[model samples]
Target: MSADSTRGAPCANCGDYAPFNVGRAGPRSGKMLCDDCADDSVAYIVDCLDCEWSYTCEEPRYNWYHAKIRVQQEGNTHETEQRVFENESHETVWRNE
Candidate 1:
């Protein structure tokens, strides 16, 4: 959750203190991660993962293990495009969006 509005604020990045607001999420967690945090997290994940691959900023915002995916490249193919995997042994129970 985020404030209704964030005016005259500090950059979540450099902390230079400017008019900044929350940024859109990247791969891992889904919260009101600031712009600076988002950038750092992206770089960190990219460097650690060692790939120029893309990601999906889809639903199941707060829980990755139970989220539905919406692909950026709807009509594409790759051997390992799925960023998150599901455990095959568990039976699935769908939830309303």
Candidate 2:
């Protein structure tokens, strides 16, 4: 597909302009997801293995938009960090420093 063809138009997944659905979280990241992709994608929650750092938001199928979440470490300290959910599995956590 031409770069300009998809400029600010249509769903990023299917290239169709009509019948678009907005993904509130995950890979879609609030972008326009076609009805097909929306149907195929699943919702997930992210949690930390070390402490009570669980992500409790309904994002799209495989994307995240956590740019300013307060994460409490094992020591009970708060820190602002950015995180992203990788796919529906939601097993990945990235810290933006």
Candidate 3:
């Protein structure tokens, strides 16, 4: 089958197929994933290089205040760093330096 034939094919992660499902590419593996699988994957991560503060999320949006609150709740007073990654290639899309 040609590449075009696989446009609405079953999701590589869930093996579910639907004509209206416009699957998303897996962030880590590049496999075609259904909406649910894609939304459940870890697409972004926040880490503090100086401390043990870390947070992860699958959504494209990240809450900086929430991350800070988490660090504070953990008694981590170190300066927190924010990092954003793309869902397609897992590349560093943004970083607070």
Best by lDDT: 3
TM-score of candidate 1 to 2 decimals? 0.20
Q: For residues 1-97, what per-residue lDDT tens digits would candidate 2 score against the true structure?
A: 5344333346566766634223321234556656555554333444554445554344333343432232223112212232333222212343432
TM-score of 2: 0.28
Clash pairs, model 2 backbone: 25-59, 25-60, 26-60, 26-63, 27-62, 27-63
Order the candidates by TM-score, highest first — what do you get? 3, 2, 1
> What TM-score would each prediction reach against the true structure?
0.20, 0.28, 0.29
For lDDT, candidate 2 versus 3, the one ahead is 3
Candidate 3 structure lDDT: 0.41
Model 3 agreement with the true structure over 34-71: per-residue lDDT tens digits: 56655652334445544455554333212233433443
The deviation in Å at residue 5 for candidate 1 is 12
Worst 10 residues of 1 by lDDT: 41-50
Task: Tell me the spans in candidate 1 whose CA falls farther than 4 Å from its real position.
Answer: 1-6, 20-41, 44-97
What is the lDDT of every predicted structure here?
Answer: 0.33, 0.40, 0.41
